[model samples]
Target: MQWRNSSRNYGLTSILLHWGVALTVVGLFALGLWMRGLNYYSQWYRTAPDIHKSVGLILLAVMVLRLVWRWLSPPPAALPTHTPLVRLASTAGHLTLYAGLFVVMLSGYLISTADGRPISVFGWFEVPALVTGIPRQEDLAGDVHFYAAWALVILAALHALAAFKHHFIDRDDTLRRMFGRAKY
Candidate 1:
């Protein structure tokens, strides 16, 4: 089904950004878990952490662009007959995801900066340090980053499950609106 806002379902740009961010977030999560499992002195562990930081900064930049795109092009219309509770839940869930993601990225950057490490953006560019001192800030930022990461995982899982429910049980076009209709 064509989405309500525009003549087409999700525009090509929207679909690309959505899938790109999804893949990046999932990869980051797995990398994070792997890095956490390694010993601090392990060279492999060091590499993973640096890669994670670099990829995360890239994700942050993409997310900013995604936000701008979203503002310029709102999501496809929701079901016309959603109950008030469902509407509230949807709004809360989306807001939580956006806020949590922003915080997670910011905390990661702060953590790296606090540790006196320059954040490399996808190995192409470096983000300048925000602060030079405060080791304790790094510890606190680490805690915040982990907490936000867990929250993001939970939120993303729920969002995906909800999409599946709409597609399979509700037999709605909600998922297809984002993914587009099958070519065949």
Candidate 2:
């Protein structure tokens, strides 16, 4: 595959980022849920937050790079089979996905630092509290994180369903395009 996207198909970078972020988000979601259920005595209870924060920072960085790459190398045109509304929805959906990534990551950061504590980056360095000493703000950030995460879950489900619809019902190349194997 080419290093950049073409009118026909996605490039290696896009495919890698798309799949990588999808997998990473899934893992993070499971880890977040699992860690939440842990008791104070559990080993991961102490480590999980740090792990989550570190990985989330990495994800935020990757997402930034992905956005840059996207701007540098535009995606293929909407499928011909797509109606005007479909095309609009596709555009809006993608924008929502990008926005959701930012929201989730930002809210996670806010929640971590909401307690007026610096975040240690996996024993490497520290990220000082961006929002400090406001319990109400912390609580609000926590709520945003929770609801935004679930919204992301719903959006992802709809995204997957739409991809499947294009493949199975619409018999289009929407899914295959992302795989960097679009014959059309």
Candidate 3:
């Protein structure tokens, strides 16, 4: 497949980034939820958070790259079968998804770095905490991270449902395009 987006199809890079970010978000959310139940004696109690933070930092890098890639190679236009409302909703949904991802990531960063410690990403490098010292920063950022994660998951589910509707009910290529298939 092509490596850059075209007017009618998503290229390999876009598809890879889309799935990578989506899967990582869901995985990190699940890990975060599971980590909350661990007690002080649990073997994974400390390990899990370290893993979560590491993966989160990597995700942040990928997100930044994805944004740059998107700017360099914009996505294809909405399918012709999409109505005006559908097109608008599609745009809004995409924007909201991007915003929500960043919010969740940023809050996660704040929660991790509130103690003025750097986050180590899989032992590769450390991201030093550049912002700290606000009272109750950790607690507030934890709440934001928790709520934003849930909101992002719910919106993602809706996104999947919309793609299903376009594929199964509407019989359109909306879903296929992300796989680098195009109706055009």
Candidate 4:
């Protein structure tokens, strides 16, 4: 597969990043939910959160890279079979996804660093707490993080359903394009 996007199809890079980000986000969300149930005496109590934070930090970096890649190699235009309402909804949905991702990540960061401590990513590096000091920062950010994460995941599910609708119902290449198998 080609490494750069074309006007008619997604390239290998876009395909990989798309799937990578999707899988990572879903995995992180699951991890977060499971870890929440761990009690103080659980063996995974500390380890689970450490893994979550490290992966979350890495995901933030990957998201930045994904945005830059989108800027560098624009995606193909919407398929002609889509109606004007579909096109507008697609655009709005994409923007909401991006916005939701950032909000969730940012709130996670705030909650992690509310005590003014840096986040250690797999002990390889630390993301310094640069924006602490808000009153009840952790509580407030935790609420935001929880709600935003749910919203992001739900929207992503809807996005996938729409793609399936396009492929199975509309019989279009919309889903195949992300898989790098569309007729460009």
Candidate 5:
């Protein structure tokens, strides 16, 4: 597959970033949910958080790359079959997805460092705290991260449903566009 996008379809880089970010975000969410349920005696209570912080940092890196890629190579145009409203909504949705990803990661970082601890990424290196010494800052970050994450969940679901709608209901190549199978 081509590495760069064309007017007709998204290139491989976009597709990989799209699906890769999707998986990592979902996995991180699942891990966060599971860690919350752990009892004090559970080994994972300690280990899980370390893993979460490490992977979340890696995900932040990937998200940065994805954003840079998107800026350098915007995706192909929205499906020509879409109406004016659909086009506008599509643009908004895309922007929200990108912004949400950034906010979620940033908030996660804040929550991790709220207690004045450096984030150790798999012990290879440490990410210095973004914020420190603010009273109850972690608590505020926790709340923001929670709500923003839920919002991202809703938006991502809607995005997926719309893709399925176009593919199954509207009989279009919306999903395939990212795979570079769309005809010119």
Candidate 6:
């Protein structure tokens, strides 16, 4: 299928970044759920919490890169005769997902920093604190982060269902275009 945004199908860089972010997001979701089941005070939970923090920071970094890539590359064209309402909904949903991702990551960082913990990026290095030491603020940030994560999960499920609809029911090129393939 002809790309909607650019003339060519997505380049190698775009495809790689798309799939990489997808995998990371799925992994993060699993990790988040697992951490919720653990006792925060236990040693097992200690490492898991740190892993969560580190991976989250990494996701934040990657997301920033992804945004830049999206801006520069754009996405494939929408299906022909797509209604204005459908187009608007598509734009709104994508914007919400990106915004939610940023807010969730930022809240996590703020919560950890306020708790007097250094944010580590994948165990490689530490991120400087966005803000330090305020118990009330930390508590508030933690609450926002937790709820935002759940919102993301719900948004993702809807996004996936939409993609499936396009791929299966509509028998369209929406999914394939992103994967660098032309519609059959």
Stretches off by above 4 angstroms in model 4 are: none
The Cα error of candidate 6 at residue 87, in Å, is 0.9
lDDT of 6: 0.79
Q: Model 4, clash count?
A: 0
lDDT of 2: 0.88
**1-184 per-residue lDDT for model 3 (tens digits):** 9999999889999999999998999999999999999999999998999999999888988999999999999998888779999999989998999999999999999998999999988788899998898899999999999999999999999999999999999998889999998765
What C-alpha lDDT values do all the predictions have? 0.81, 0.88, 0.93, 0.94, 0.87, 0.79
lDDT of 4 at 103: 93
TM-score for each candidate, following the candidate numbering: 0.88, 0.95, 0.97, 0.98, 0.94, 0.87
Cα RMSD to the true fold for all candidates = 3.1, 1.3, 0.9, 0.9, 1.3, 2.9
Q: Estimate, for each residue in 71-133, the C-alpha lDDT of model 4 and write its tens digit.
A: 999999898888999999999999999899899999999999999999999999999998889
Clashes of 5: 0
Best model per lDDT: 4
lDDT of 2 by residue, 24-133 (tens): 98888888878889999998889998898898888998999999999999998888879999999989998998999899988888887877787788989887787666
Overall local distance difference test of candidate 4: 0.94
Per-residue alpha-carbon lDDT of candidate 1 for residues 55-104, written as tens digits (9 for 90 to 100): 88888889999888888877766666556886798889989988988999
> Residue-wise lDDT of candidate 6 within 1-184, one digit each (tens)?
2323454366666777777877777788788789879886877687887888888888888898888878887766666745688789989998998998899899988988985667776678999886875659888998998899889879988988988888898787777767877554
Which candidate do you rate higher for lDDT, 4 or 5?
A: 4
| Candidate 5 RMSD computed on C-alpha atoms after optimal superposition onto the true structure | 1.3
Residue 92 miss distance in model 1 (angstroms)? 1.2
